[model samples]
Target: MRRRPATPLLLSATLVTLAATLALGSTPGAAAPGTQSAGTQSVGAQSSGARLSSTPAGAGTDPDEALAAARTALGLGDGAQSRGPGQPVGEGNEATMALRDLRVALPQLGAEQRREGEALLARPTDGGDDPVGQGYDSRSKKLCSGNVCVHYVTKGADRPDSQKWVRKTLQVMNKVWDFETGTLGYRKPVSDRSLPQGKNGGNGKFDVYLKELSGQRLYGYCAPEYLVKGNKRLANGYCVLDDDFAKAEYGRKPLDTLRVTAAHEFFHAIQFNYDYREDRWLLESTATWVEERFADDVNDNRQYLPVGQVRVPDEPLDIFSTTFGRHYGNWAWWEFLTQKYGGGIVRSVWKQAGQFKGAGRDYSTKALTKVLAAKGGFSRNYARFAAVNNNPAAFYPEGASWPSAARIANLKLSKDATRKSQATTVDHMSAQNVDVTPAAELKDKAWTLRLTLDGPAAATKPMAAVLVQNKKGAWDERLLEFNRKGRARLSVPFSARRVDAVTVSLVNTSTSFDCWEDQAYSCAGIADHDAAPFEVTAKVFKDK
Candidate 1:
């Protein structure tokens, strides 16, 4: 793994000790069972919207070909027979019975859902109204066997696209839910335009509505419009996407992308189902980690493949500019952390999260630091992702693992103990600063520096600090800057000979103190106690 300026043994040691104490309180779980997690809840199960029903257009009600296909995929012998109410047909797993019953009862659907399903299915199937206008619908009910059943109200010629998606969806679920740890998957018919916008076009997205029954909310782009409309009871619900992007990325043809999306969403589902709500970073990071690590794209389950290349650029700011690199970067962070430690550690944190009304302040940042410290040190976490892609030069000061894509490949990984001089004194600051000193000394070779304020004035008229250094004989300021709540000691390339010493100090660029309402201040003196110092022979490495 790449090596950077190590965090001060004192700071790391302090954090580790604190984390160990904190982890003793952590537990594991997801959202509480009944309270719907953020997003829309499925209320249709309470009452059918249209009050509709279904029947065969002419004679045979059975979808012979579709049944044959489902049977083949299920590996049930072709001789599999359709049993009536009390007749036992096949393996008789509660889940299978739930599925079979759902298939048989699909003709009776509520109005609104059935209408929407028909319209969407109509567009893709390219067929005129069912020869004489016969429609399909399913009765929505919780079976005695205890699985949620959803049937697509069928109308017109059964669209091949819709049928194919339905079969694939069931097939995937049959395998995924084989563990049957409480969550169950079954199709429901819907006429809502939003229904089919998920993983398999209209055939799959409606699962979110079903998720509402289980109380899982949605986030991302789909939040504002659908999730938070003022019903505090429904406060946390919204869709991440109207449709699953993986399917779109697969070019619209029915593909196995739905399986991946199922795993992705269900991971969230399981978490929501369990109320595991502590640190959002741990929650999201772990979800992403599991998605990439568990997603399988091949026909045989033996071979494994990541869903796609980590879209490192798309991640939120904290993960990219601060913690990990980008999309793949964050996943890499969690993946590394999990591999080194174990996933059970996350469950421990999740138990703590559920107790929170909401994760307040820099919850993610603090949580991670605490978790790392509790588990001994951040080195284990760092070592996990950096194991293969070690970079040398820019490793120090922490947060080095999360750089731009271009910088990731050329990472330098080397560890040489050479004496070098650098500076950590406050470079430039005016007298208007508060109680602290204008300058400070930072001796630790650590890269990311964090500072916490003490006084009320410190909190009000906050100060800002920047880490500047000389690179290749010339002075260059990096974009990594911090305010009162936090400070970062950066480790970029430095030159000892060209420059005498680098400085760590406060800079007051803002003149306005009028915004001091939250005990806010724009300028203050820095004590300089923990300001990181410049060094000559620091060790660096690039393992990638």
Candidate 2:
């Protein structure tokens, strides 16, 4: 959301992230039984990373955007880098690219922030003699499992309180590897042969570093250690988690907090092996969703729903807010997807967005649309998704614990004549819900609430759904029709004798985009048809 010069890594990043280890191809993530659309065509899914020439040092002026991005990527507390003991920080996985951006711009920053950025981008090394970092030996002790190695300190302020924590962390990561790679069938993380220590944490397994991140308020983070040269830009990656999930900070079982964070952060390490420069929102939402797949009982990701697309329906679904966590909060959308198409849907979307040999390598939503094309179409199903969010408790299997879609207007009627609601606008892939409740006066069976809609041009892709709830609380759902001019009318029973409430859900399903322009919306492009307007009016009368 900050106005800054697009870095070379970012300008072409929306197209091709890192070089591919395998051959290049843009295809859907997983194979399914339906007619798969190619999704939105990427500019160049197989484009070479060699094309990206780093910006000259301080070529541009503003370093704040680059610095904030770097700190978030490193999980160094966006609000404040330092926190009192036990305070919790958020997670971010795009540190490799973010650090690169900041590294190039460090010359422009003030001394304090510049030193912070330098330390973040530096190799994970700490010695008692080292300045500005956890005082530990240069070589962190490690224990390995099937395909991952856990790195930790034996004695230091940053060391885990118990060595048992080290083995437990290893078990947690091994479980993540088994479920993600063995059970769910996602690719494993690439090896960090070029790890600065000359040791790939014992035999090139995915390395996880344990340090006093809890002091800095970080849960965990994954960063690409080395980007291989190829068209897909596949990279070797590493992760760092808090030395301990202190009970005082997270207010939960240390093991429970550890489970979800490991599941969430490890997915980012896997993502780097797929596409190091993939869309930020896709990278985060899917990672957050994977935590549920790996450890459903923890349900820690639920904390983000208040800021998610379902709870904040007026914002575009793919917009990546640097200050806001909507990117991570929208995990529920993928949950909606998995429950609908079965578990393989997320993998299929990732497959479509992959740059691997048989990968679709399409941009984020493009791959999603392609995967959902067979289920009906992205447009239709997405509109239904908006409707589903209208009452997540009714649609999602685990949604009983989740919040419902936000309502823009709450209209109550006792004996209403006619009320024209305010005209509001919604962005693409977002919605607005209006709840009309009977105020216990209109009890006759003849009473009805007549509703009308005036929307933007049909080309803008406006959609509407009506939910009529009876006294028993059962809902009748249907699509409200509209003409080419975006006008429509419908009527539903509103009598207190039989009805409970009527909800009108308005949707904006526009997918038009100007690719590679703004790095805010889906595909890092600008939404071409954003802020489509709609107005609804209601008249309660008797049909005797």
Candidate 3:
């Protein structure tokens, strides 16, 4: 059985939300192009192809244009009706349109749920020609190709900071899109600012329009304070506003929470861009997965496809803090999938969803299960993804090494050791050992044994157990989970009497790791008995 490749251990760097801290001073990070620095601020918040044969002609154009056409053709544009007409403003009309489109795509809602979504669209009222909540510019009409758009009210528009802010935010969005779909295609810029909505509360759905209003809401929620305390309606991203911390200008700082918040919102954008029609679990889990992985991949002071803009880790397990329950669990799931099945599986799943028969919400776990099964049965590959998603911190730890048992220093074995029956056999990625059996017969005495592993330690499951066979043909076995260093030890106290010679054999079991997508097989042993054996010299004590 071939051993799975050791998972790369990288640092965990998460983005944290900084409440109350405003964007007043010229901080290290750039601000939105034209907006004045407020002391603090708030922030917030896809699909599919068809049975190709069932679609009308010219359906295969650029996905972006195809998406726009599909939405418009589906009468989604005409669906933007706000609930109760609570307010009217510069981009309120557009907000209403967005609300309508959301209803069409996300249609299975009770009255209250529908109203909740609708209320978000109506919060921005115009303040005498300039809308207070809508982030739109009345005078100019620009076309941002693939991203969401909103118009700016001149008096309320932060024009100077527009380019700086929009580009930065969009770059983040692109990273998410590429990661999720495994496609690196570019979406057009935000030609119209109205693409995103205002912060009327409820999952940053409203916060998406923060640029329009000069006044920023606390975390941009219509009721940021109330929602912070266990409000299920706003539970997903509400933790950012919990009693834990609150500093208005924090969003503008170089903090992990803030970056994660951005990553969270970018996750939503990716869903919209692709035809991802899933629930909070899939959506949130994917975001958490992407945020940490990207942060690790782009460590500070590294030059790759892009330079700079990388985040650093504050502690060993900071990534775990970004989530609770299944959010972190899902991160592990994704990691396992990516590592074992290859990153391509994730991308295939995302694109495949667009062709799913039902609406996004109807695409449930059962559906995905069937899809995965059809492609290939789920096994250790899925497990690896789960492990990574559940405990992202495990991947990167401070002052840790690629654990290897070969690095151990001593070697000794029982006097009974012989060529046909040795103490142990060693195999690893770095090297293989065979034929290290003792030639001389052992005297009846105790033995202290130590052997060094040749490679890094790996965390795997259903590991093979080492077997020992006595000269008389009786055999005993023990399974093991090697530590960071690939090494294990055992002492035999037979006084070289009961045991004549001990032959070490390796056994394979199709064990599973928490982060593997499917069960994997280990490679066959590379060496016969070259593995170093021990000559026992110490008494074997049952109690430690």
Best by TM-score: 2
The root-mean-square deviation over C-alpha atoms between each candidate and the true structure, in angstroms, is 21.7, 8.4, 20.3
TM-score of each: 0.36, 0.82, 0.36
- Span of ten consecutive residues with least summed lDDT in model 2: 35-44
lDDT tens digits, residues 445-543, model 2?
888888899898887778898889887868788886568999989988888889888888888888887776635776557788787888888778888
Which of candidates 2 and 3 reaches a greater TM-score? 2
> Candidate 2, 385: how far from true, in Å?
2.2
On the 0 to 100 scale, the lDDT of residue 321 in model 3 is 20
Predicted model with the maximum lDDT: 2
Candidate lDDT values, in order = 0.27, 0.69, 0.28
Model 1 per-residue lDDT tens digits across residues 258-311: 454444444553443222222223434455455544452322111111211122
Give the range where candidate 1 is weakest over 10 consecutive residues by summed lDDT: 211-220
Candidate 2, after superposition: displacement of residue 114 in Å? 11
lDDT against true structure, model 1: 0.27
- Candidate number with the higher lDDT (2 or 3): 2
* TM-score of candidate 2 to 2 decimals: 0.82
